[model samples]
Target: MTAETLSIPGLAKPASRIALGTWAIGGAMWGGADDANAARTIDKALDLGINVIDTAPVYGFGHSEEVVGRAVEGKRDKVILATKVGLNWQGGKIFRDSRPARIEQEIEDSLRRLRTEYIDLYQVHWPDVETPLEETARALENLVKAGKVRALGVSNFSPAQMDEFSKFAPLATIQPPYNLFEREIEQDVLPAAVRNKLVVLAYGPLCRGLLSGRMTADRKFEGDDLRNHDPKFQQPRFDQYLKAVEDLKGIAEKHGKSMLALAVRWVLDRGPTIALWGARKPEQISGVEEAFGWTLDEADMKAIDTILTRDIQNPVGPEFMAPPARNRVQGQ
Candidate 1:
C-alpha cells in the first residue's frame, strides 16, 4: 500500500505522511550505523512510498546528512528533504544557537553535507533563549529569499515562540515529538499549529522504539544509545511502560497490526500531518506500510489511555532529550 501524502504550501508536491527520520542513521548514537545499510534503508523507504526524509546537522555531527545525501543522490526530485539548523556542538558539547551568523554558516554546511542546492523544508532544531527570535527568523527568511530553502519550519518551539518567530518570517510547519506514549504536544502545540494553519510533523512516532513491541525487559543498550539516559528506560519506569505495551498488544492484535504500526497510526490520527519514523536499516522500517489506511476510533483511544493510566503510575515527558543552553553548560 502507498503511504498517504500531505501538501505543504511551498513544496512542489505533497509529502508522504510517514517521513524517514535519520537520527539513528547518524551512527553516533543508538549503537552505530553501517553506511550501506543506511542507504538501503532510504531506498527501502522510497520503495515503500515514503518520500519525505528528515535529518539534522547535529545528528552524528553531520554524518546522518552525508548518509542521506548519498542515499538520495540521483533521485533528489523524488524526495522532500527536511533538515534543521541551530543547536551547534563544540569540543564534544552541544548547545542551542540560532544567531543569524550561526544559521548562515550552518545552512551552508548542511547544504554541502546533504548535497542539495535547496532544502525543501528547513527548521530550527530547538528554540534558543539566548538569541533574539527575530534574528534567527530573519536569517532563515534570507535563505528562502536566496533560494536555498523552500519552506520554513520550527521544531520544539512553544506557541508563543512560534508567534514571535512568525512575526519575522513565514512559518509553514511545526515539528514536535508526538506518539502514543508521548502526547504532550496535544496540550498546546497542536492547537497552535491549527490556529496558525501550519502543518504538523510529529517526530518520535514510536517513542524511541518503546512502543515497537520489540523492546524486552532483558534488552540492553550499548554505545551512546540515548535510551540509556531516558527515564522511561530506567528499571521501574521501563517495567511500567513494558507492562502498558503488553496490554496494548491485545489492541494491536485486534486491529491485525504490529505494535509499531499501531503506534504510528495513533500519531497520524491525532492530527499530525506526518509521523517521522526513525530507522537506520532496511528491516527496521519493514512494517511502515501497515500504518496507512487505518486509524483509531474513540473507543480505541480511550482504551489505550486507560491502559497507560493503569500501568504507568509515574509517567514522564520527553524532557530529558532537551539539550542544555550554551550558558547553562556545566563549567562553562
Candidate 2:
C-alpha cells in the first residue's frame, strides 16, 4: 500500500493508514446513494492503495455490505474487509442487541451479504449494556476459533467495558468516533487501546464533513441526513465551527494542502492506527494523497489547539447519536 500501514496483533495483514469508510454509501442517514458510483469509488480507493474497507449491517441495514460485496467480488484477497455486529433495526428504528443468538445469526447474514467466506475483522457495532460483556466476548471468541472471523473488535466501548471484555476474549481493535472536534476518546479510549495493544481505527476523521472546509453558513442538510441533528450543525455552534474552518484555510494553504487533506493528515499525525474516510464518490478521495507524505509540525498542532480552544466554547461528543439498549427501549 502507498499509504503507511500498521500491524495489529491478530490481524492477517497490516492495514493502510487510510481505510475507505462506507457509511455514506449505505444510502441511509447521509441521504441518497448511487450504487454504481459507490462501487466505482470502492474500486478507486483500492487502486489508490487504501486496503481497508469498513462497513456495518446497520449502515443502510445491510445495503452497504451488499454494495461492498459487489465491489470486492474479484479483489477480496487484495483488501482487509471489516464490518460490525450488535446493532439491529426494524421498521427504521435502531436498537442494540448483543445476545449470543443475534450475534450468531448476524454473522451468517453478514457473510451472505458480503459474499465472503470469512470476514477479516468483525466488530461489535456498539456496546449493549443489556447483554453481558462475557456473553458477547464468548460469542466473538467462538467465531474466531471457528474461522468465521479473523479478528474481534468493539466499537464505542469505554476502557472499563473493554477491561471486562478482555476477561473472555482478545480485542484486536477499537473502532471509535475520533476526529479533531471529537477529542473525547483521546484522553481515555486512545490510551487504553495503546495499553491493551488494540489497534485504533478512528472514524469521522473529517468530523462528519464539517472539516471539509467546503461547508458554508448556508449549506443545507436535507432528508434523513444525520448531521441535521448534530450539535455542530446547529446555529451559533455551526457559525463558530465554520469560522474555525475559515481560519484553518490558512494553515492548510501553508502546508500546500486542501482543507480535507489537512483534516485527514491531522488525524493520522495525532496517532490513530488508521483514519477511516467516508466517501460516496471517487472525487471525494482526490485529496487523499495530501494526507500522506507530510507530517503536521508542532506549530501546526499548536495553531489547531488554539483555534479549537478559542472558537468552540461549547464542545460536544457523539454520545447523542448512540442507539438505545434493548432493556431501555420504551416501545419496539
Computed on alpha carbons, the lDDT of every model, listed in order, comes to 0.92, 0.90
List runs of model 2 lying over 4 Å from the truth. Answer: 330-332
lDDT of 1 by residue, 43-118 (tens): 9999999999999999999999999998899999999999999988878688998889899999999999999999
Q: Model 2 — which ten-residue stretch has the worst lDDT?
A: 323-332
TM-score of 2: 0.97
Mark the regions of model 1 whose C-alpha exceeds 4 Å error after superposition. Answer: 330-332
Candidate 2: Cα lDDT at 81: 93
Least accurate 10 contiguous residues by lDDT in model 1: 323-332
CA error at residue 171 for candidate 1, angstroms:
0.5
Model 2 over residues 33-133: C-alpha lDDT tens digits?
A: 78999999999999999999999999898999999999999998998999999998767889999999999999999999999999999999999988899
